[model samples]
Target: MIISQQLDTKTDHQVQAIPLDSIAQAQGTNIPFEVCVDHANFVRPNPQKHVNRLRSDNHYQGLSSQEILNLPPWKDDFFYFSYYAGLNGTGFMGFEAGLWSLSNSQSKSHDKCVDKFIENHRQDQRNPMTQLWIFNHKLKQIQWKNNKYIFILEYRGKGFQVINYRKTAWDLAQDQTVWFEFVDTKGNRLGGCTEGWTCPIRKK
Candidate 1:
């Protein structure tokens, strides 16, 4: 886009062209996350519209050690409580930092699974509602192989599943450190996830 300018040196030249980038740079537009690559956008593009209430374009690079540590807990995925990331060091952003997604964050995932299974189970001889999780977890690391340490996962929610989960899993300390690699449960990228799938942490 060109701007209109009035000049006396020429025969009434009314249009002037100026680079938008030049204007933008002159203004010293602040980059998001205080991160940049030599005044150039280093952040890899993503399909998601926003992260941390900011336009993704602001910061083109990855998260710094301090930045990752400061992520809000309420934003943590899972049914509600909290499931924060286990970030260490400056790393790539988004999936490039590893599958890094909480399938629960998808919101509709639970509904989709329950609805489909309920519809199918309604046809059974005995009336019952059923839903199953099939290898939904997509863990980037395998911690169970070495068997040097033990890892536990706990979930709290309604229904029979809660009973099982409670017996098998309970509350870990608040502000507990959990290493995770969120993945695309939508099947966009597969590590162990296909639609309706979740990544699992292999703990010994």
Candidate 2:
């Protein structure tokens, strides 16, 4: 049997509360539960929770040493919702630019995007790219913007980076589906193939 939960949004804006047991019995015990909020205003209710405090102060609060590969698609994707302040730490390296690439779990391959980037860069000064991704703490989505880096080897191979001011710090969160690419010296992101949040949808 399919159980439908209806929420009333008239005047008061009320949610229908039902027993979790009833819903679990209707679906199977082995299957995961899906909570669907039918229509969202897309309005953020709390502002304080979205702040990334680590960058605000010189001190840091370390992120849990999460195994990036272990999480489910949706949960893994939610890493975009977090702030990787550690990228600006003492052990941090310099920047790299990259073309947007898809995760292994995604239908497309990162190599395809990499190849396209290589092809595009062959004629221009920007060849041989690096990939980067970050968790957006506010939006709760993985953002590819400002995270990718493209490097030209012959230009200036070795150099040091100083964090004079973090312009990209404490920005809004981004969704993973969108594509972006750019190269910068100080803030260009690093790393390839990051884990994001798990999918909330149920398998039919």
Candidate 3:
């Protein structure tokens, strides 16, 4: 969905804050693990378009191997997750990552089906690279405000990271949020993009 159209036109300082429960209720459901998998599996974009977009985007272009390795998990790890999750008819990309993190860190049950799925696709045409980060931290919280799903993640030493996923008023496609951010507990920005590719950290 187009985040710009979904947001209130008020200045950043004047934006209203709504509770997470209210936002989830209005949106119908929290971002379920199943939904993330389904979208990754069933929805297919043109391979050429995908490759070209990756090549053309300034945000992704001109990066060294070390730079790519050190990039944020969302950018580096999520790319492979999206690729592998979409490989088979089952979409388990985001769910697998979440489960992997939970299983390793919190002793949660790791779904065997997810592991087998990844193994089966290991040599597939779209060979997604293995994720460097296990994303051991679970989502600290998820809130909805101004037509966005605000995902809060906690890292051991990183304080807090906030991701805002927005939706449009009339769009039917259940797509991922194009704009997101990583912020700290005090509302200080760590990293993220604003509506028009503006600096969310600076804007905050």
**Which number leads on TM-score?**
3
The local distance difference test score of model 1 is: 0.23
- The positional error of residue 29 in candidate 1, measured at the CA in angstroms, is 57
Local distance difference test values of all predictions, in order: 0.23, 0.21, 0.30
User: Compared with the true structure, what per-residue lDDT tens digits does model 3 show for residues 1-204?
Assistant: 000012221221211123212113354344322111111112112334333333453654685544433333322221212223342312223322222122121111123334533563565323222211213122444444445434444433211111222233322244444344544455554554432211223211
| Model 3 CA lDDT for position 28 | 32
lDDT assessment of candidate 3 = 0.30
TM-score of model number 2: 0.17
TM-score of each: 0.18, 0.17, 0.32
- Name the regions of candidate 3 deviating beyond 4 angstroms: 1-137, 157-178, 193-204
- Model 3 alpha-carbon miss at residue 171, Å: 7.0
lDDT of model 2 at position 111: 30
For model 1, the superposed segments whose C-alpha errors exceed 4 Å read 1-49, 52-106, 111-164, 168-204
lDDT of 2 by residue, 1-204 (tens): 111123222221112222122111221122121111111211111223212321232332333213211223212211121222233421121111101111122102223332333453454331122222221111111122344212201112211110001112112133443222222234333223332221221111
Instruction: Name the lDDT value of residue 126 in candidate 3.
Output: 33
RMSD of each: 23.9, 23.1, 16.4
